[model samples]
Target: MASVQRRLSALLFGVALAGTTLAGTASAHVRYVVDDPADVGSIVSFVASTLAVPAHAAIVGGSALATATGLLAFRRVRPFQRDRDVFADAMADYRDLLPWLLRLAIGIPLVGAGFSGYYFTPLLESDARLLFIGLGFLLLFGLATRLVAAVGLLLYLAGVAVDAVLLLQFEYVGGFLALVLVGSGRPSADDVLERVASDDDSTYARVDPVHALATRFRERVAPAEPYAPVAIRLSLAGAFVYLGLVEKLLNPGYALAVVAKYDLTAIVPVAPELWVVGAALAEIAVGVVLAVGLYTRAAAGLSLVLFTLTLFGLPDDPVLAHLSLFGLASALVITGAGPFSVDELLRTRSASPEDPDA
Candidate 1:
């Protein structure tokens, strides 16, 4: 238990260090040529510059105190009193849903990237857009998924190389990378192949060794049931943290402007600037707690509330944008943080003497 705690502490320290480095970079790029909130890519830079050092210190101090208090209280209780780990129980058959979740997260974005019709222009030109859309459908329908995922991965890699904006958009990059590693989920063509192979073991045994090896290799990268929920939690955590840092903190002026436009100040009975600062602090804290997988249910539930509130203020153009994030937050609330989080570690160590493996 002590060793595990040390390892967890080390991992968390590394993540915090990385975040600090990124924040510094964000701060350096505060001023930009384009201040349009619609651009989205520059939001983090705006946040770092908007919040002064004292403001940052106050928020950090408050979050630390809260986290410490919560940890102490959590230590005193026997929360995981169930026979099994709650996360494992909730995700008993998660593998069955992994493909669908991956498809929605990765494929939907590809579709959006290529969508250029009545209301909006495509992110890519005609030929590229068509190819992108084709890849998206292939992924979504579970048709030739490996080939499509490979192509999509390469395409995103190329885009990142050419356009730095994609690097800043963690959601898209994270989704694409996850698909590349996991391939399509169950009920896809991959499953069909597996079923066919299993149906005739003798025939499969006679197949070329190289082909079998390739198949085995692909399976190695497939998403496992135990980890999918945690992966989703991490992805949402990164996206939210980035948004909180870049979108709200870095761009307080724009945030305040939007709040005023939507009469958010009137609804909350707080000054717009104070509201922006408070919201940013909450967002950042939620992101950090979620990222570390600590009190994940509470953090995600709070995030869901925040996301729901935003829906009331969002214009039509951005309303759809928040829906997926809201869904992710809601899913976390239902699923908890899974095995990859600090909550699980704490629960495991704090198990009673009678339940040695708890």
Candidate 2:
């Protein structure tokens, strides 16, 4: 058991800290490290010009047609329908992993921020690295999970109060809240201790620490578990929208700087100004889709694709800072839109009127 704990600790540290710290050029915490351009065209002008480009207009129309056709095919075809059901069922089977994933989503970024010399946002310098690191490792260990998450949230809120730049990493709010709602998951020390405490036959049962208190704490918050997905989705959506609108659209100069720095226009064969505008529009659209829970899995899958493309295309972007977004997206793919979502309402309406079970 001691050796197993050691291995887990080692693995967590290696992935959360060592791997990220070793990457020299990676520094994207909302592109904070990117230098601003001396001057740039207005976002409105860029958008207007892109709309005037015949090739760009054709590509947009073609994409919309393809998406609509694909959706229709999935609905009409037996194999496609069967595959969708099978994939959803597979995802549902692993619902127990949600908490652990949320923990990692919140924890890894905290550890990364601490090690990377930031205070939740790369824009804000950090002086409490050990505090963040300690809270992070505790969450990863799944010990005092709820308490740790709550503390993390409080610290983040305090940081936001100090510097609004923390808002750029606002997705952390959803992750921490979700962890508070769901608590620790399987393969965690908390789960192991709880099991031990429940089993009278086990030698360590009587001395199991924290399990009883943790149980009472979790039970108190059990009623809100259904909203976990809501919190995560909304938070992620907000971050995407904020990044697109406030960061890119309103601050086109810096965004255009990013485009030119990475030479994104060369890869896409579009004007550099159009690249900034197009990205802003795409991100806003993604956020809106996620917020509504319309084709949620598809949106999340696209989010993963977007994150991957960004990581590969812009080599300087911090892989660690974006790890939380990846975890959240993966969680959504697993959980979908839980309650209070358009998907839930649609599902209910689609159920058979005479025999809903069927």
Candidate 3:
């Protein structure tokens, strides 16, 4: 389901319009930049045509078969368990960085959106540039992080209500909610203030106004902190699914336009239909695997690869727009699946003495 997430730069008029035009060229979304791109005929027809090609069908089938075989082999052999456990331990030790990682993921995009003259997404121009920039800086600094994240989330929700396009980056909602639950990690203003406030005789504690509210907020929300990964995973998976299923498969014209405009088939030397359908299917598969928490870290790795490939594959794709996805994927590689995940279930089941084979 990884089909979507557009750029934040679009033009209006005058000098600013010119700036928008220039900025938009850096955007990766062909639909936004192209005038009227070719549709990939009908989705069904295009898919059938691709599959009808014996070579294409064999390629797709072989890939799926290989993937299935690999998964089964990994389960049965469980090779490199010691090294894997070491890597897992290493990842666990860095859990404190999770809050900062989330902030970087969501905050950088908000700032990019502000500077690009669009709202939360490229679907609409924004008037609140300074506001978004300000909030982004605050989140980046880890200053009043929870409050800023809350504000960011509220503003995003409001925008979504009006246009529904903001849903394209719905992961921001999860990121914000997770921030509110997790608070700022070490070395942040919030963390320092909390420490100072906890000290009854600290001189700085008397002037720290946010410390009490932060403490109270933490006490109330701390219980839900474990679900942060759940929110992020589901939100990201939904975004990917929408992008793959709706933006690419249903509205194939924009993608086909991009393919033709860029002559992408020349790069890979494949039918454009195969390229589009292949990408859509890859995205959907990644999203489903991620949603189910199967090899969570591995899924994140694939996400990183896909995002990077899109950036390089489409020379004009906006680098800024993909920053959030990149950040989120990196964070997931660190955090893995939280509660309410198959990863958790498997871990619990594997711990049972009666299930020694597991």
Best candidate (score: TM-score): 3
TM-scores for every predicted model: 0.68, 0.82, 0.85
Query: In model 2, what lDDT does residue 192 have?
Result: 78
What is candidate 3's lDDT per residue for 16-40, written digit by digit as tens? 2221111211113455556685756
Off by over 4 Å in 1: 1-75, 78-88, 117-127, 197-214, 222-231, 319-340, 352-358
Q: For candidate 2, lDDT tens digit of each residue in 64-161? A: 67767875775345344555777888888989989888888778888988888888777789889999898889889998888898898888879877
**TM-score, cand. 3:** 0.85
User: Which ranges of candidate 2 are over 4 A from the true structure?
Assistant: 1-30, 41-79, 199-212, 352-358
lDDT tens digits by residue: candidate 1, 1-358: 4554455445434533444324311111112212433333455554444354576557656766987887778656646646435554565446456556667656665666556420111222344667767776788787666667667656655765665444343344334444554566676766665556555565864663444654766765543434445555666666666656765677666666566656777786755655666776766676777777887767767776766665554533333223345545555655567666787786677635322121
The per-model lDDT (C-alpha) reads: 0.55, 0.71, 0.70
| Cα distance off (Å), candidate 1, residue 159 | 2.2
Candidate 3 weakest ten by summed lDDT: 4-13
Misplaced by over 4 Å in model 3 are: 1-35, 351-358
Weakest 10 consecutive residues, lDDT, candidate 1?
24-33
Q: Which of the two, 1 or 2, has more TM-score?
A: 2
